[model samples]
Target: MTIRTAVMAALLGAALTGSAVAQSGGDVGGVWQTQAGDANVRVSKCGTQLCGVIVSLRDKIDPRTGQPAIDDKNPDPKLATRSMIGVHLFFGMKPTGANTWSGQIYNADDGKYYASNVALMGPGTLKVEGCVGALCGGENWSRVSR
Candidate 1:
């Protein structure tokens, strides 16, 4: 093949690969949870952007007290709400740059929405942050072992 043709082909291939990598988002697809709070979340793509949702509930057990974690905020007085499962407890995310995404975050505890951002910390970890107006908080999620 001509040198020009070969160069063009190589450039085209590189562009395609870059685009795919950007869309796939390195390693953001998986289950993630926090160490300190109840932020167990699963990351997935909503349309073209990455998003997270609560899919499982950690068994109700307190680490320090070895007692069952009780849901003190449950609206129903008698119903046990310590662990919530299968809630669409997050919002969609869009790519902002390399390994960074901006989106909306939903708090399952209170059903509130806020500004959200996420970044891949490692191969199986994602650092997720959410902001309430101006103040922000974040959590580190380890990839769930499936």
Candidate 2:
């Protein structure tokens, strides 16, 4: 083949490959329901990395106060009074592989941060795993909105 033709073919091949890789990664920006179906989080790009924030809760009212639930469990005393809704629970998640990301997830229930891995199981499902020391647990979250 002529040198000009070969160069054109290489450029075309690279473009196609890049497009395929981007598509395979699958966008995780959306609202997802936790496995227990008690909470919903919205995932979106926060600067260069991805972050997830609590958007809704099945039990919205604080049992003790009969008011909206607050982040009473937060380690920071000042932040403890902040509402749980719209709290960023996951942060610094960057794509690690096709459909996978690594980050930190904050567990409001325990008032702790854990090493977390997130993966898109399918177009509509996400698997979120958090590890503390040697113990790890994961839950499948369904996409609630895009």
lDDT of 1 by residue, 58-116 (tens): 76565765775544445555634444554554566777656777888766555566799
lDDT of 2: 0.85
Q: What is the lDDT of residue 56 in candidate 2?
A: 98
Q: lDDT: which candidate is best?
A: 2
Q: Model 2, 29-88: lDDT tens per residue? A: 899999999899998766546689999999999889999999898889999999999899
The 10-residue segment with the lowest total lDDT in model 2: 15-24
The per-model lDDT (C-alpha) reads: 0.69, 0.85
Task: Report how far residue 108 has shifted in candidate 2, in Å.
Answer: 0.6
Q: Residue 130, candidate 2: how far off, in angstroms?
A: 0.6
